[model samples]
Target: MGSSLLPEEFEQAALGLKSGETRRFEISLPADHPDAQLAGKAIQYILTLKKVEQPRYPDIDADFAVSLGIDGGDLERMRAEIKENLERETQRCIRLLLQRQVMDCLLECAALDAPRTLVEQDQRRLAEIARQNMEKQGARNHNAPISAEMFKERAERRIKLGLICAELIQQHDLQAQPEQVRAAVETLSKSYQAPQEIVRWYYADTQRLAEVEAEVAERNIIDFVLSKAKVEQQPMSFEALAKASQSLFTICDKRPEAKEGPPER
Candidate 1:
């Protein structure tokens, strides 16, 4: 992004430069950069402008619809499909928002010491997940050094939440029942074309069945929390809801590291 300065600085330097220009520069990254391996490190960079071009957009015609993979190149049909997809995405995001609020409420109500063993286990798990995601994205250095400290805060939070959920589940007898699990499975299958077939597929595998049961139990916990907590509902436009959910998701994905050592219990 830059030759002799930061990425933003390099962007500024690139302005007015003709194509095929080359520049060499060095810059130091911030300590809080998401990639711990390169954080606070000064590195040399060589930038070459291979090409510059204006953006091109397809015309809003049948060809555009066909490019979107809509059969028959029906523009109206494409719009309808896009609308349906957006509606589903909005609904899913709204549910995630509600679940996040419930979890926040639960964490506020109870604080416990996160076991070191559990924290380490979850830290490794999160790190592995991040690595796999990078690999899936075709990252050049998928196995690049990643500081474990990056996941410590998130791992501890997860451990604490797990402990709290386990205690509440036991005390309130919130174990997922057979009927409830079946209902959960049915609800999940509704999104599929062959709902009954999906339901049967889940029931056919113990592991799949157990995953739904776990979700049912967690949903019960969220419901229980919402029941006890003082809840205020605010109507949000689809745009606002989507923005808020995306912000929350970004925070979760970053998993900022703790600035200080773990507090004493």
Candidate 2:
């Protein structure tokens, strides 16, 4: 087992222990240790080696294909499905990369001061969003203070982009049409199971519909910007692009499965 913190002496003493062996040691925690309860304290720790288990993987054969519940136990079909999933994921990553590039280009070309009021409001919103994300990831410190200052630069950038997008939208009449919003929702829904149901779910609520409309409008802005901007197309492998997007992309709970278009809601 590996630990973030261990006194060298304690580790050395425990190194020779076999299964079912036990050892006791004490060490002083650093003053600024992250765990408040253990900080600046001498603590005794008992190490025990439980029975070790080795991982065993089954061989990929007819039985393995059957175990995966592939229709007709066909390995070729499974492989094709996996390829389809990979291609879909690759396309999603490419879309995100394009959006990021478009935003970066806009930031470089446009010059405008971010309004203080909007920046502050966005800072608060960003701070809250960060806190919520941390909570969702099982962070224990609910009371931990998240400073809005940490998001000031991001908020300012967002404000500037919003202002620029607004101006462009107004000047070019780039507002999302009803059909465009519906198409966007349907396209997004196709990635999930029972996609027609998902489409209906989106249209059932006005707020949900509005969210899709807003996203469609933003996508229109990206398309308009790309039309005007000089873009360099760089070829990259799916694996490399997926790796590059890891930091920026937040994986949703559900993996995309449905490939066919959903019935219109």
Candidate 3:
């Protein structure tokens, strides 16, 4: 009976039985049943028995191995893959911890009040970015919908950081010059196949050029902060550094716009 019905239909049938409704069952085996595989076959059993019970999975072993499309030998490879994934996750967590510590310290030292407008703008920008990312991945974010209140909180934090960073930049006089911008463009070009085309495109629009310059200026600020910071030069692996940078950037990416006021006291 279960074999002939969909999962939903099976559940409904079970529910009907529980509700004291009469349900007739007809059972017959097909001609292919004798030759069918039994290792992971779905078997349908029917009887005039008054009670129907939910099935429970058995303990895993050699039989379970056949169900997972892997033999005992293949299990080792899966274990190795799981170990690698765990290591990566651990490294990522460590990086996030470090980045959070750094940001929290900076925020404490550089206390600033963010503008409502700037916070709203940053929240909107974040939502737009998330939507675009979902679109690019060909996936819809049905589970995590964006809300204005949530955005407001995120935007506030971002705006505060932006104000702090902007203040730092001004205090240090860290501006990206034309030569620095050109050098940055050249460095970026090396990553593309058509270097000249990329360079041309970057220089073609004044706004685009300014955006690149701003990025360079931000990097300069990061470098300057590292210089002034009492960093304990921990000898981390390349993977650790990559993970740390990713975590650091994730926070930096959400920095808020500067408010229209003097830097926070």
Order the candidates by lDDT, highest first: 1, 2, 3
- Clashing pairs for predicted structure model 1, backbone only: 3-25, 4-25
Where does candidate 3 stray beyond 4 Å?
1-104, 140-145, 247-251, 254-265
Give me the displacement of residue 129 in model 1, in angstroms.
Answer: 2.3
RMSD of 1: 9.0
Taking all chains together, each candidate's TM-score versus the true structure is: 0.63, 0.67, 0.52
lDDT tens digits, residue span 1-265, model 3: 4443343444454554543346644334443231112212454644233666678986545555545544563656545545765676665555455555555667788757888888777777766655555566687663465555545555676678778768877999888988999988876574444668888887888877877777677666666776778877567765555544542443444533322321121
Q: What overall lDDT, based on C-alpha atoms, would model 2 receive against the true structure?
A: 0.71
Worst 10 residues of 1 by lDDT: 256-265
Candidate 1 stretches with Cα past 4 Å from truth are: 1-91, 247-265
Cα deviation at 167, candidate 1, in Å, is 1.2
> lDDT score, residue 82, model 2?
69
**Model 2, which residues run further than 4 Å from truth?**
1-70, 74-77, 249-265
Kindly report which residue pairs in candidate 2 clash with one another: none
Kindly give the stretch of ten consecutive residues in candidate 2 with the minimal lDDT sum: 249-258
- Each model's number of backbone clashes? 2, 0, 2
Candidate closest to the true structure, highest TM-score: 2
